[model samples]
Target: MTTVAAELWDGPASEPVLTTVRVPVPCVARPGTTLWHLDGPCRCFVGGPPPEFAPSTARG
Candidate 1:
């Protein structure tokens, strides 16, 4: 398993929570977490390819 950062989004009525997930490729999170591969626009309902794994660039 690898460590990757994720921005968990439930729905329009909720906010996004940035966190880390340790899992193999092609994985899935809970149910409503909007998953997006850091490598690209690849979408995952639960989990998928782990991103490059990095902190938010906006926080320079």
Candidate 2:
């Protein structure tokens, strides 16, 4: 588990407040690192970004 400070992106410039978030082990991955999840192996970027992977194509 990891604790991180996250900012709320609601409305224009007010006092910036950070929220503490605890991410479960499986859900957390290093930036630009590859790991196997329920969706197979993929390269994880950072912070709510989608993972990058190539779909497997069967050959006849």
Candidate 3:
């Protein structure tokens, strides 16, 4: 259950309205909308170690 969408138009075709802003944000989209930065940025984990097999195959 993860959603991020924007199509809230209230002007056109003698007002053929359509509104959808599945929320969770500090709002800013009301002049011609389309803005999605949904749950973005908690991604940075780079530290590597694991791959060591050579002491003539480590087995006396």
Candidate 4:
């Protein structure tokens, strides 16, 4: 488990507030030469803004 600070809005009229959320870290496994699997797909949550609302970042 990992805790991260995030901004969340309760309602449309409410201002966004900073809060701490517990996110489960994903576990990955690769078996042999051709098998790859994610062990916790159900425990995953999207941790960032949607792609349409994401801020631009510089990539090099």
Q: Tell me the whole-model lDDT of each prediction, alpha carbons only.
A: 0.44, 0.41, 0.39, 0.32
Candidates 1 and 4 compared: the better one by TM-score is: 4
Off by over 4 Å in 1: 1-38, 55-60
Q: Write the per-residue lDDT of candidate 1 for residues 1-60, one digit (tens) a residue.
A: 344556665555565555444333322343344333445433454454553333344754
Each model's TM-score, in the order given? 0.18, 0.23, 0.22, 0.20
Model 3, residue 56: what's the lDDT?
Answer: 44
Give every collision pair in model 1: 27-47, 28-46, 28-47, 29-46, 29-47
Model 2, 1-60: lDDT tens digits are: 333434555555775555544332332464444422333322255334454433346687
Cα miss at 45, model 3 (Å)? 8.3
Better of 3 and 4 by TM-score: 3
TM-score of 1: 0.18
Candidate 4 at residue 2, lDDT?
Answer: 35
Q: How well does model 1 score by local distance difference test?
A: 0.44
Clash list (residue pairs), candidate 3: none
Displacement of the residue 45 alpha carbon in candidate 1, Å: 1.4
On the 0 to 100 scale, the lDDT of residue 36 in model 4 is 18
lDDT of 4 by residue, 6-57 (tens): 4566555565555544333232221222221122222223443211212336
Using lDDT, rank the candidates from best to worst. 1, 2, 3, 4
